[model samples]
Target: MQRAKFAVTLFATVMAIGLTGCGEEKKPEAPKPEAAASTPPPAATVEIKIGTVGPLTGSIAHLGKDNENGVVLAIEQANAAKITIDGKPAHFTLISEDDQADPKVGTTVAQKLVDDKVAGVVGHLNSGVTIPASAIYHQAGIPMITGSATNPQLTEQGFDNIFRVVGRDDQQGPAIASYLAATEKPKVVAVIDDSTAYGEGLADQVAKTLKSEGVKVLAREKGTDKTTDWKAVLTKIKGEKPNAVFFGGMDATGGPLMKQARELGIKAVFAFGDGACTDKMHELAGEAAEGLLCSQAGIPPQAASKAFLEAYKAKFNTDPILYAPFTYDAANLLIQAMKEANSADPKKYLPFLQKIDYSGATGKIEFDAKGDRKDAEITIFVMKNGKVEPIAVVKSGKTIPFDEFMKSMGGA
Candidate 1:
């Protein structure tokens, strides 16, 4: 037997012996009493709670459910792998709360999570909701990673307790503009938003960029979340004869707009941000979604790490959405940092998380000091021939130059 040194910080040590030499004159070894009939004790189980907040039972229910499913899948994977935390086998349980895409509800849920003493948090699909919810989480010292919220200001507050696995709207919004300028080159564009924080922010960013890129803004309008029929809104845009239309809202609104806009004979290209990429969009828009284009942070689930996809499928029994894989990555990265720090306390894990080079479902995930995903990849998808296909993918290690990006978008 080849012998090697074994160092175990938490428990029992092991000694290996080499039988390379048999001593002919070995002194009579005292009977070792059969090594006290050694037996292994049961592995200790430690409980860690994970909290998630999303629109679990509202217009965005599908998105929330899918994100929760992914996080559940990660917990399953961790359990099967015998994940250890603080030298003890760790098992995670999810505490899910519904925000209904409401910021006030989101804040209440965040406070509830703080009371629950969860080890980490994984969601708040809406940027508007995440913004306020994160404030509560920060004050409580509970670290959270959001997979879907894309507002640039979410982490700009520099709260150490918050992190994002997805790219912010600033990176994705202008990237869509770049795509339009380089490929479609529509002469004029019409823009509309739901008037919510997330919807308006993304729309404003894209509009600023589009105008700078020489695409004329013929009309800009707002629609209510409660309004299902956007025919009037669609009619107004169609008369502008803009070559393209950009919408900033969730599938609940975007889906109906796509269906109505097509029926209204708006021949303009319909493009949206990550908020519109849910599977629900296909169901809502039907055939109208066929030619739509959108942008999102991270690659498609199929393009993510194989282990994550396999594990996700085994647990969720369905293909993941845009944010699911990002959530899984964020959760595992948090776990990795906790283990490496050898502490579940947020303070100890904070610094390690700051410097982590995490290999997650989305790809290599690292963070800047501000808790933004570093060197993120953004993918643009176009619904073609009845399916969404990735048309362009860009990965960069440096923060996108805001001024240059603005200039390229015709906004600087």
Candidate 2:
């Protein structure tokens, strides 16, 4: 009986083990794989081309390069900021062209930019170049903003697409002439200009203002933009013994004229317009640069915003010569208008640009109905310590001391 009981218990234990093994026979259904990561595709990007034209290969190439650098810096900053238009990431591309500061070349460059489908343009530094190039851009419905061109005829042509960041030559001419009349108190002043549109136009305004001030004006003297030797003209003017002499030309020629005037013992106070108002004057004119008076259509380079100055130096490893701040502002104005309008098309953004009131590296920037900068300031400078230092700022017919103007602007 005991043997029979042990056999029955052993059979029951085998059945229990067989049932447990059958219940685990699915083999855990093979470990399931993880779903692939659901990464959204990269955000859609749009390429926007912006054109910049200047005298990239001539005497004023430095100034043109400065303008180009300004636009480049602005584009770089805008890209880094991830600027978007119409829900698409904007990748700005700079298309730089060399105008050689020639109007013919300027028009060609402008056409090239238009064909390239650039959203906007910031260049043609010379008024002569800007005037003709503007027509091309207008025909293409492309907006063009000049940072240095000051000829009033540019905006007077009634093209809504034309704009400038600097004051007009009409405004600048009177400011410098008024300052010269008040300070020099000259009984007679001689006016000279390079035969270019900008130089002749500015010189005409100066002559008019001097005549209005009851100062006897000598007949206009002429020189080409490339005239480096002015000994003949200087000798002729010296014979007249004018109390003051004003040159409406670029520093490239103006500097040599000033040095030659001094060497010829002209003994007259030398004054120049924005073209000659540069630190390079010291290098160009040597010791003769000192005590020379000049006027800039906008504030001095030193008067630009601190943030802009620092960034400019860091990016270019050099200080801004002139008009870079304006160009920088011009480029930003284009981008800002596109963002405001939510479109990169020139027709769509042009309206926004017309109505924009932007605070830029230079200062508050707004446009008049004529597309000229409103409330633009003309700064009178004197060469001191090999630098063009501001002495006064003329804005809206009111003259303010440089220090006072800077304080009003919250410092440079």
Clashes of each: 4, 0
- Residue-by-residue lDDT tens digits, candidate 1, 1-412: 1233233422232222222223322211211221122212344656677788789988889999888887877776665676677777666666788988899899988888898788889988988899989988888888899988877889999898889988777777777766776678899888899988788888888898888878787657999765689998888777778888888888898999999988987788889988886656788889889878888876666666666666777766777865788888777877888888887778788788888987767767888888998867677888876667777765562223333332332320
Can you write out model 2's per-residue Cα lDDT over 231-322, one digit (the tens) per residue?
99999999999999999999999999999999999889989988898889999999988989888788766677878888999999999988
In terms of TM-score, the best-performing candidate is 2
Give TM per candidate: 0.67, 0.73
Off by over 4 Å in 2: 1-43, 102-104, 184-204, 210-268, 275-290, 385-388, 406-412
Cα-based lDDT at residue 12, candidate 1: 36
lDDT of 1: 0.77
Worst 10 residues of 2 by lDDT: 30-39
